[model samples]
Target: MKVKFYATFREMVGRKEVEVHGVKTVGELIDYLAEHYSPDIKRELLETPRVGPNKPIDGMILVNGHNVLHLKGLDTELKEEDEVHIFPPAGGG
Candidate 1:
C-alpha cells in the first residue's frame, strides 16, 4: 500500500510517501509505521492520553480524503492503489 504523510507528519516521517507491504487494515498500518519510524514519531503518533498507547487519534488518519471514523475505523481495508494520508489536525484563526 502507498501511505502519504502531510504537513507535520511528513516532517516527522522524513518522507512524503512510503510503500509498505503486508498492510491490510488502517490499524495494522499505523502499528507498522509506529514501529518503523523513530521513537519520537511513535510517541507522538501512538501515545495519546485520551486513547491510550495503541490507538491513534481518529482525526489524524484520512483514507482517500475520507476520515477513517466514517469508514470502518481502524479496520478500514486498503488496496494496493488506495491512498492513505496521515496528517495532524490543522488549526488557524
Candidate 2:
C-alpha cells in the first residue's frame, strides 16, 4: 500500500510517502507507522475526542479517495494497491 502523509506528518516520518505491506486494516497501518514515528500519532489521529481507550480514531483518514468515516472507520479493510492519504489538522484554511 502507498501511504502519504500531509502537513507536519511528512516531517514526522521524514518523507511524504511510504509503502507498507501486510496491513489488513487502517488501525494496523497506523500502529505500524506510529511505532516508527511517535505515539502522538495515536494521540492526534486515533485518541482525539477520547471516544475510548481502544476506540478507533475519527480523524481525516482517506483510503483510495474515499473517507473511512463512510466506510468502516479504522476497521476499514485495505488492499495491496490501496492508496492511504493521511491529512493532519490544518490551520488558516
Score residue 86 of candidate 2 by CA lDDT.
Answer: 91
Residue range 1-93, candidate 2, lDDT tens digits: 999988877777888899999999998988999997766666688766744544456457899999887899888999999999998755565
Taken over the whole model, the C-alpha lDDT of each candidate is 0.74, 0.82
lDDT of 1 by residue, 1-93 (tens): 788888877887899999988889887888788889645544555565645434446237777888886788778998777888887655578
Q: Give the 10-residue window scoring lowest on summed lDDT in candidate 1.
A: 50-59
Task: Candidate 1: give the clashing pairs.
Answer: none
21, model 2: CA deviation in Å?
0.2
Give the number of the best model, judged by lDDT.
2
Best candidate per TM-score, number? 2
Q: What value of lDDT does candidate 2 attain over all alpha carbons?
A: 0.82
